[model samples]
Target: MARVEELLGDELLEAIRGRAAGYDEANSFCHEDLAELQAAGYLKMFVPAEWGGSGYRLQDASRAQLRLATAAPATALAVNMHLVWTGVARVLQARGDQSLEFVLREAGQGEIFGFGVSEAGNDQMLLDSRTVAAPQEGGGYSFTGTKVFTSLSPAWTRLGVFGRDDTGAGPQLVWAFINRQAPGYTIKDDWDTLGMRASQSCTTVLEGVAADPDRVFRKLPVGPNPDALIFGIFATFEVLLASVYAGIGQRAVELAVDAAQRRMSLKTGRSYAQDPDIRRHVAGAALAMDGLYPQLESIARDVDDLADHGSFWFAKLAGVKIRATETARQVVELALRTAGGSAYFRGSELERLYRDVLAGLYHPSDDESAHATIATAWLGPPED
Candidate 1:
């Protein structure tokens, strides 16, 4: 924690926060923030130390991400995409799988990775893909499809994409990494949105983009199964996403506290903080956050320690994400109420947080998916 604080000091966070509003207003990518983070080697935090990285464990990385999100949620969210790949590699390495070693090497070499697995209306999550993976003569595949919400689109050098490879006897899912310089790929600057504008998660159009055999990492059955790659992706993505939202909730509570302490009530002729109602609101937010912090940390620690949860791991990961996100949403709402009408302004941090929190609802393992997963885990899969 001290190392993380030293790396991302107050001066740097102030600088990042100073530029956050401007970037969000313009709906632009946080290029300067990214450059600063890259210079500090923050981008390679998960890469193994032997590969010239900090090699922090999953728990430490989650803490670092939480702190980063407190200053700039959009920047932290964009960086999450890059961390996801490196974290996946680390997860596999811990499991004695060297399949994603190249990811660590490339990330240490300053190559940013982005996730391109999401597709519009494809709510099956990783279970299926709308993209077509046309097999080539020498074992490579050309993908033709569009991937949505591709954060770090403008900056990533490598993108992890998946598509259906039906050339075999049965329909197989192909997961691979594709170079950004590859032909037939276009990054659209169509990221105008309600919030988290600095993320610049634009739509990526792939028209026969080629991924060499070396980059094609996994070929697994379509539906949910016990694949290490799948587990790594699910565990890392959900936990980190939860961490980001939890930070937002933390910041909201702090803001509410500050507002309450400073606000004056003419009727009572005293500070709002002295009022029971204001204190109760702040306490409620604090209690909600208190419950979330332990869960987020415990789950992340379990991943780092490689605690055996067997088939229950998926449910645990999904539960953490769902809980953290919903809790953050509730906390932010309370903060806005505590802050009064001032928080309703367009440029207000609380307003931005309110909109940013909405994004969590749309991420993987959403409420619907999470509930179903938990139910299935507790009471077997539903009969056909």
Candidate 2:
């Protein structure tokens, strides 16, 4: 029920949008924006009201993120990792699972959570991991492996990490939280990229970093299975991720429309908005973006309502993420064309968005994986 505009306000978003270009130019983290958001209680948006949080639902959070991304995609993305964890905890609790209650409580207390799921060459995603989760003598586990794209690497106090424990029978996947201050882990300062630079999604190398007893959570068997935690994560992550890119697409179309209305045609001596070709291009981008909002809303609403779509859930989630991201890329390209050479300038917002939207392709459930997942959902598994 909470409105994002009230929580973020026009002034705050304007400041974030102003900083986005500078942060990208310097290849720095959105520390200032994070500070403001933390102060605004944005960090605890998903935490329960009883725990001193806003208690916003997944739909509210998704919509807020979509708006935030329009102002600053990288900041929205940097903060999204934290949102994902808190949202996951919220999802788990909504389903009557109290296992992640501490996550909600801590987030409410102002502790930031970071995403640590991505790894190099581990396309199995949640189903498998290359990180070694060796069980400790008394309890807990020591994780040893490299996790790439650890977003919010600098600001997060707790990082949700997972790994494969071969020491156990048949190799089980160990999910746990690693303290940022934990020993034997290195946060590499190597986040320079084409876009989304403010995220500071650096590489994290864990050399036997310890996860204390109680921190070691799920221990599911390798490969996909029916686990609520997995479902919760997939639902939250994909939806929020989609929302952020959808914001980018929306912003791009807005910029295109503005450019069309403001620029004049020398031959016709009229605004480009009156030009049929320009109007069609802007409309095409707007039309693509128009299709995304309902899909995102429906998906978020389903996650909130816990609608039992059964096996179709994964396909639907993956489809929306791919669609939102791919559509964003298309809309940005269209905007770049409509805005003409001015948009190609280094400091232009459209230019930055053009770069930022490309990062969507690298996220989980990539084109190949998503298409395969969708195909399997409808056509069954491939022939041997």
lDDT of each: 0.92, 0.93
Estimate the TM-score for candidate 2: 0.99
Candidate 1: clashing pairs of residues: none
Q: Please give, for residues 1-384, the per-residue lDDT of candidate 2 as tens digits.
A: 347888888899999999999999999999999999999889899987888888999999998999999999999999999999999999999999989899999998989999888899998999999999999987899999999999999999999999998875699999999888889899999998999999999999999999999888789999998999999999999999999999999999999999999999999999999988888899999999999999999999999998999889999999999999999999999998898899989999999999999999999889999999999999999999
All candidates' TM-scores?
Answer: 0.98, 0.99
Worst 10 residues of 1 by lDDT: 1-10
Q: What is the C-alpha RMSD of each candidate to the true structure, in Å?
A: 1.1, 0.8
Scored by TM-score, the top model is 2
| lDDT (Cα, tens digit) per residue for candidate 1, span 1-384 | 237887688899889988988998888999999999998889989977777788888898899999999989999999999999999999999999999999999999999999999999998889899999999879899999999999998899999999998888988899999998899889998999888889999999999999999999999888876888999999999989999999999999999999998899999889999989889999999999999999999999999999999878999999999999999999999999889999999999999999988999889998998998999989998999
Best candidate according to lDDT: 2
